[model samples]
Target chain A: MKSTQRNMRRDILDGLHVGIPIAMAYFAVAFSLGIIAAKAGLTAPMGFVSSFFTRASAGEYGTYTLIAAHAAYAELVVMCLVINLRYMLMSAALSQKIAPGTSRWHRLLMAVCITDEVFGVSYAHPGYTPPAYTYSAALISSLFWALGCALGIVAGNILPQQMVTALSMALYGMFLGIIIPPARKDRNVLYALAASFVLSGLCAAAPVVSGLSSGTRIVVLTVLISAVAAWLKPVNTEADGEA
Target chain B: MEKHSVIIYILIAILTTNLIRVVPMALIKGPIRNRFVRSFLYYVPYVTLAVMTFPDMILVTPTPLPGVLAFAAGIIAAWLRLGLFAVAAICCAIVYLLSMLFAG
Candidate 1:
């Protein structure tokens, strides 16, 4: 019991090390989402609630776009579903990192915490996060995300409109920060990204394909465009990542 | 109209959101052996993010110059490894400054 307690403590510290920067970055982005939501007729409290389940900036913003159009709930549901579908793929890739004996309950818990940032940080961790530590990571990250949205909504509401409009760019900037790290270190990543542009652009222009909601198109095109990098499996030589 | 409907609506709203966000993550375990599916899952994020950001990088202003300059600003900020917050702040500041200089 004492050993397990020590293990938990160690995991907690390790989780803190990983979670803070990612969560802080996430908070900055989510704050802008809240501000935008406030501008879009959502209250600060509603922004907080909408953000909890959305767990992603692009999809949440996209859904807000639909909501502005006064699109139906079905559209909202599909918008969120299609945009967030990548989480399923993310979760599957993650299952490799988790040990096989991990229980259904544990899988469910980890699944709930499967935000892009969480997956990104977790995947790149130096070692396997003990199942013991996963909960703390989830709790800490979720709290930061939810708190950030709350801050954005409240801040967006109180702050002048000009400032809120300015902060909206922060989300795209966050994406640049994410992509550049891998892109700089690996030419292969750059190629994959460049291909994403061509494929997504083509997918956008084709008349038959272009009519679909942006969410569905994202899932279809990204899956197609990213096939090269993923097939080559850049990080696969490390056996530990697979098992 | 019923008074309790608002409470019901909120519950429904929260429940609906949770269902889309959380339910499948609980149920979907799979064989998932096909190389295409496996690889597709892995790179979905990179491509998805790229597609999302492409427009911003491509078309920032009515005239291409301001937009092109903002594009350069973001590329430089990102290449410098300034992290997420700094990249965002620098890009926003540069855009606002440029807008003031040119658009005004």
Candidate 2:
């Protein structure tokens, strides 16, 4: 039992090494979110605390916009649900990769921190990921994310106007870095990405669909484009370690 | 809004986000067998990021020019397999310089 505990501790540290890069990316993104939260009248602590609980980026930002506009509570809830529903698919995929015998509580904990970057880095891991490693990675990544939000909120008060505008691109750069490597390696991913881009452009420009809220458009377009890509070219992901 | 409403908003965010994430892991114990479904899940990470990034990136910046330039720089650097730090730094520099030049 002692040896097993030692091994698990080792796994968590190994996970943290990879988690650091992801944490850096999250820091950049959350910084932008922090500034937005401040602009929306949220206190720094309120913005930081929200990052701890709900790691969803677009969902948090969307909620801020709705609250500022004084949208109905029901609409806000439904919008968050739709904006964050993609996490269901990601969590389900991760469930298949976690080591067998991982406790229910550990699984529950992991589920709470399933951000886009967390899932991406974990999924790209070659084989069966130990529950401890996954949990540690999520813990580290979320910590940095929350810290970034707190910093951004604080910094928003003191930073010059032009500097904040420049800093916002850090999040965009992080997102682009994440997708480009995979899209370059796989033709199917490239197609799916193109489809998403075109669909997003049309949804904004095309007269009829243009009426939809940004949240609905993102959810609908992601599902439609990914499904078609999967149907047209299904890659076997059975190489995932199942220990 | 009242000061207390912030707490309510955070609660709502936590409840909704975790609902989707937790329910799946709690119920789905094994690898899904359906090829189409598996493929769909596999493709989701990429498509979700792509859809979220575009259009949204354009809107976040003060003007289309700086955002577009920054986005183009990021794509080029990332495609070259530059590490995340490099990608972000390059894009931020480009956006900053362009905004300074044009929006000045």
Candidate 3:
């Protein structure tokens, strides 16, 4: 029992070390989220609480967009589901690394914490990951994310109006930061990015498609464009092993 | 939205996101081996980001020129493989300057 406890402590410490960089990364993204939340007319406290409740960045942004537009509840729910669909895949991948003996409750707990960075870091673990390590990493990274959101909200309220408007541009920059590097690396991603851009633009502008609610337009555009891209350039795992 | 409905919105967001995360992990064990499904999932995030950013990005700013300039700066920085912090910081600064110059 003593040995197990010692091992658990060491693992958790190691997890914290890995989690620090992730926390820093999330701080940048969540800071932008804070500004956007404010622009959407959310109170700082509400922004802080929502950030605490949902760590999914894109989903939170989508939620804010819908709320600001006074979208219906069903629309907001569907938009969020679409925005956060990636997490399902991430948790699915992480599930494979967890030991078979882990309890269902533990799996559910880990699922709550599975973000892109957490899942990526966990995948590097050579064998079964201890629950302590996963939980510790999740706790630290999420705490930083929440902290960053709170800081951003406070700063948003305090800053001059001009600066706040300027800061809102950072949200788009953050999204570009996410998609650009990968698009540069792969032709397929480049093609997919262009397709998504043009299609989304058309959806917003063309009279027929523009008539749809923003929530529906976004969902339809994302699904159709991504499906086409996937079918056009299916990533052959056989060719690029472990990509 | 009413104060009460705001609570409902937040809860729904949390519930849907957590549902996706929890349901998949609980049901699927072992790496997904199917190439088609893997490819589809892989493309979802980037495509979603791309679609969400455009049009909205251009419309968000007070003027389209500042918005386009800021977006161009971001694209260039990201193409140079700058880190997310650097890209966002640079774009925000550029957008602020351009907005002041043009919108003033």
lDDT by residue (tens digit), candidate 1, A35-135: 66655567666666666655666667776665556556665656666777777666766665566566777777676667666666565555654655555
Point out where model 2 deviates above 4 Å. A1-10, A237-243, B1-4
lDDT of 2 by residue, B1-104 (tens): 53337667777877888898999999987667778888888888888888887877777778887788787888899999896668878877887787778767
Worst 10 contiguous positions by lDDT, candidate 3 chain A: A116-125
| Model 3 lDDT tens row, A58-137 | 78888887777777889877887766776776676577667877888888898888765566456556587777777777
Task: Point out where model 3 deviates above 4 Å.
Answer: A1-46, A61-79, A82-86, A89-110, A114-141, A148-155, A238-243, B1-9
Choose 1 or 3, whichever is better by lDDT. 3
Error of 3 at A125 (Å): 11
DockQ, each predicted model = 0.40, 0.65, 0.53
lDDT minimum window of 10 residues, candidate 2 chain A: A234-243
In order of appearance, the predictions have TM-scores of: 0.77, 0.90, 0.73
| Candidate 1 interface RMSD, angstroms, 1 decimal | 3.9
Docking quality band of candidate 2, CAPRI definitions: medium
lDDT of 1: 0.64
Candidate 3 chain A TM is 0.68
